[model samples]
Target: MVKDLHGKNIIITGASGGIGEKMARLCAERGANLALVARRTDKLAAMKEELEQRYSIDIYTFSLDVSNMEKVEEVFPLILERFKVIDVLVNNAGYGIFTYAHDADMKEVKSMFDVNVLGLIACTQQVLPKMLATKSGHIINIASQAGKIATPKSSTYSATKHAVLGYSNSLRMEVASQGVYITTVNPGPIETNFFDIADKEGTYVKNVQRYMLKPEYVARKVVDVMLTPTREVNLPRWMNLGSKVFAIAPRLFEWAGRGVFNKK
Candidate 1:
């Protein structure tokens, strides 16, 4: 068994609600201190109030838009000031949309990469130095199953997640000898506000609802991952297997799963 997370400093981005919030609560229960980052201050404050009630832990809130490199640079230092040693960093701030590549909104596409890819990288880079200094730290990246197997109507979103997966895979190996753990999460779908934004058309998320993973399930597993360092996590095991199959026999799988894969 891995050591308890008691007193470990963990920073979670996009932590105002959903999986991020649930993960914070789970980590708090494990006695971990948290730095919750999000663009919404009111939501962050509310979360802090309730989490403190149940767990005696230091909960710091930062209203941040991780996509803004300037803001990230400005605020990350304050985190270091309060929490001298960073133990874990969870890059959970990301979103996706269901739209064909040709019909995709460039604004949304750029924004996705900004937050999903660049933003995740910026946050990881911020704490990376400290982790290197200590030769001990964990970095958890929230990618997606789409990253593993690209599908129609989610081309741009899939590209962003694919970037995350590539980075995590390379980074994990780079820092392994230095004792830093990097874990990438590829979850199929979850019951969260993410669907509201991702599926504005009410298409994909609705159809995939039955196969969706729960926020709490992912949250609990994320916390468990922090305690027990691992390479990667793909939730709802069946979906993970499909990704593997797609990787092994792309043409056959795509031909057989055309409707679901091509649906708009």
Candidate 2:
């Protein structure tokens, strides 16, 4: 079982919308003080106001683009000053760009990685020292099922998520002795604006929308993990199992995925 999270200060990146926003609300409802980070100041401000009125908890919103390493360095200390000690770190800021490697724009791919991988790493590094000093904390990364299995037209996005899984897994072991926990939340298909963020044209967007899962389901599981000491949490267990199965048999998985796409 995990310890209680009541009164704990938590930091959630990309909290302006989608999964991040949902997670923020869920955490607040559970009595966690929050430092919400996202590039959208207006959205965060509105959320902060709503949560404060509804929950009567302290909420701080920072307009930050986690992909900017320099900005991250500058903003983290300010976050610490406001929260005093961050008990949980949620690296939930990311998006997808569905395109084959050969045809995908390198700049777009870089942006995805900057937010998905480097941003996660930079934020984690900044929070680690404090967590280590206190000998307690949770690092929950919002990874994707695509990270565990290859998918057509999402090669670059998949690669970066795979890196996240690998990085999180390794870091978990490295910090186990220190009483700090690292977990990767592999969500199959959260019904969020992720597809829209992909900025895909043509039939690709329509095809991707068919497998959407509600973001609340993902957010609920994140709360479950924070309240407990699970090393990893995979939403909609069947899909998680399928990701593992497909990883072992790429051709068959590709064939099935293609068929699914064709049907849509």
Candidate 3:
């Protein structure tokens, strides 16, 4: 049965554009109140205005760089205070710059870890106590298929996602008996501005453009699972199949898919 999101308070991070923005719209359409967080206040303001005009639900916008632990600590409590309770928290603020392992810069590596892994953890920590106390809440972490099936030129990005998957898995088990739920979204490449930074040379996108999932498609899949006990979501079911095979036979999969993996 499809769960009703009406009146639920959902917090979506990195909601200025891409799947995050799309998820915000989907949630709003279903009568879900929204808290949109991103570094782009202007875009968030525009979205807030439009969604408020279209939906009867309340909307809040926060200018946050999750990597900044201080800001994360300050902003999250303010959100909780405004909404009184957070029904769902989507940890989606993340970026990647594909570079060969040897060519990877230390600064970029630290930034990626800080934003993609530590930032996500810090935000989750802030809301977890409340969620556990209330015995109700959902935490969605946006990971990547690269976390499962590592490819060339994305070592650091893949590592960050791997950490997310690991963390989410552990947290899910820890909170299974409680009413709180944890879901990790491991999507393949999607049609979004994400590639503008991850693939500056345009090689990866050019190679995989035909197979990229649409932003709307991914967002809808995510929104559909909201308030449910779904364990994990993997986009492009076919790509997920490949990940399964790779898991069972790493050597064979890596050797056979080397060409596809090196597109970046």
Candidate 4:
């Protein structure tokens, strides 16, 4: 049976667009009050106004760059002040720049880690204490299928997601006895603006356009599992099969799937 989200305080990072925006809408539809965080304040404000009008739930918008640690520290308290407690935290704020390791720019690489890995950790820490005290809360990290099956040209981005998976796995065990839950979302290529930076040449998107998952589909899958003890949510179950195959026989899988892996 599905859990109830009515009146729950859900915090979604990177809520301006893509799956984040879609998730926000779904949560609001379920009567969940929201705290939307993103760097795009204008888009967030517009969403806030629209959702408030459409749903009878309260909505708060916070302009945040998760990569900025000090700002993360400052903003989370403000969210708590408004909502009193966070029932769910969806750490969906991250980006990637696909490039061969040798050709990768250091600046871009550092920025990716700061936002995708450290930034996620920083945000999780802020709510953990309160969640533990309350013995109830959920932390959802948006990872990638690349974390499970590494591919060419996405070395750094994949590494960050791998870190996310590792961190979430360990954290889940630590909080198992408690009421807190940790969930990681691993999705294949989705039809979103993420490729605007990850694949500027459009080669990857063009290659996988036919198989791309829709944002609404991914968002709905995520929202359905909210407040549940779902360990992981993997989109496009077929891709997840490939990940399992890669894990069991890395050498053979890489040899046979070289062409598919290099699509990026």
Candidate 5:
């Protein structure tokens, strides 16, 4: 089991807003030093200032786009130099692009993969050696319910998340003996800018807007699972059950999903 956050050095990507921002504050409350990373330097700086003022904990901010692996490699080491050690890495930088298979742009697909799959992989790779050397660390991957089930208009986005699900589990097993822990937090839907950013013309976006979950709710669940060290965590248990069952039996699930999606 992993230790509490007090005095631990933590790194959170996409820390400018949404669940990532909430996680940063929660970690501060637990007395962890944080390195907040995002593309928005102003936002990162503001959050860093607030956390330092309120919690009196060490806080560093970096304006980074995780999709750039080289930049991630360079910035991460600098963060480590500042903090001296990183005990946790939260791979929370991601976006959703909900579009039908044919309607999806290849460029958008690449962007999704770069951020959700490759970026996540690169960050974890950078941190793995340090964690393994010490034989202690925790990696929290923020995925989605779409990771397990392939919804109609969210094909590419779902694919990337699915990759996360498989990759996190495999990484967990590989590092289990070394005392490192990896957990995947799959939340169904969260009331965030996801709908605004997603392809609005897609069927998935239309459907998702109708059943939105709050980012704070999802963030809290993520924190709870991290503290407890669960292998796989899903919020709103019913959605988890329904999605998995749907994954196991696609035809029946598709029929049901269609019924629900088609309702006016």
Candidate 6:
């Protein structure tokens, strides 16, 4: 277990709001120095001021769209220049749009993959060489339970998460020989503005409102997991059990979970 986060330099993308924001606050409370990245400059600035006031550790803010590969490359160097070697990388920048595959906008589909998949890949590639050189590091990708249990109306979103899972799994093994640790967080629906757009109709959120995980709960779990590296983390154990069932018996799950799984 890693325990204390004091002075650990961590980089968290999508830190302006939602789960990313919650993770940033928690890490700061634990004494980790942070580089908060997001496109919302104003929000980032406000968050930085608040966090800096509460914690003595360094909190740097960067405003950039994670999908922009060039900007990520450029800003990341500056962050490293400021914070030195990044002890932890949190790939939490992602978005989703719920719609049937046939009716989905091609542009929206591409954006999801760009931010959720390629953006994550770009950031990881930028950090890996340094982590490998030091022989110590941790990478946490904020995936979704949608990745493990794909269903109707979220096919594209789920596809991107599946890609995250596949990449994280392979990368973890590849870097296992070194000291780098990779953890994929697969959380069920989280209470955030994400659903405002992800489910503009509000149908899914309404149906599963009771089961949605709190952002703080999810964030704390992610920060704690950094202490003890694990292959994967499926949040809110009850949801994880559903994912496990789907993994073990797909046909059975499909037959039994027709209504429940279709909630999303």
213: Cα error in model 1, Å: 0.7
lDDT of 6: 0.91
What do the candidate models score in CA lDDT, each in turn?
A: 0.91, 0.85, 0.94, 0.95, 0.83, 0.91
Per-residue lDDT of model 4, residues 1-264, tens digit only:
478999999999999999999999999999999999999999999999999999999999999999999999999999989987789999999999999999999999999999999999999998999999999999999999988988999999999999999999999999999999999999999999999999999999999999999999999999999999999999899999999998899999999998888887
Instruction: Give per-residue CA lDDT, model 2, range 19-137, as digits (tens).
Output: 89998998898889999999999999999999999996899888889899999999999998887677999999999887767998889989999999999999999999998998988
Show model 6 residue runs off by greater than 4 Å.
none
Which runs in model 3 stand beyond 4 Å of their true positions?
none
The number of clashing residue pairs in each candidate reads 0, 2, 0, 0, 1, 1
Model 4 lDDT at residue 112: 99
What is candidate 1's lDDT per residue for 15-34, written digit by digit as tens? Answer: 99889999988889889999
Superposed Cα deviation of residue 39, candidate 5 (Å): 0.5
Tens-place lDDT per residue, model 5, 1-264, is 434778988899999988999988888988889999999889888888878999969998997899998999899889878865668899999998766689789999999999999999999998888888888888999998888877666788889999999999999889989988899988877777666687455544455566767788787667665644578878768888988788689888888778664421
Between candidates 1 and 3, name the one with more favorable TM-score: 3
lDDT of 4: 0.95
lDDT (0-100) at residue 28 of candidate 1? 91
Estimated TM-score for each candidate: 0.97, 0.93, 0.99, 0.99, 0.93, 0.97
Ranking by lDDT: 4, 3, 6, 1, 2, 5
Candidate 4 residue 206 Cα shift, in angstroms, is: 0.6
- Candidate 3 residue lDDT tens string, 141-229: 99999899989999999999999999999999999998999999999999999999999999999999999999999999999998899
Which 10 consecutive positions of candidate 4 have the poorest summed lDDT? 1-10
Which 10-residue span in candidate 6 carries the lowest summed lDDT? 225-234
Q: Which parts of model 4 are misplaced by more than 4 Å?
A: none
Residue-level lDDT tens digits of model 6 in 24-46: 99999999999999999899999
TM-score of decoy 3:
0.99
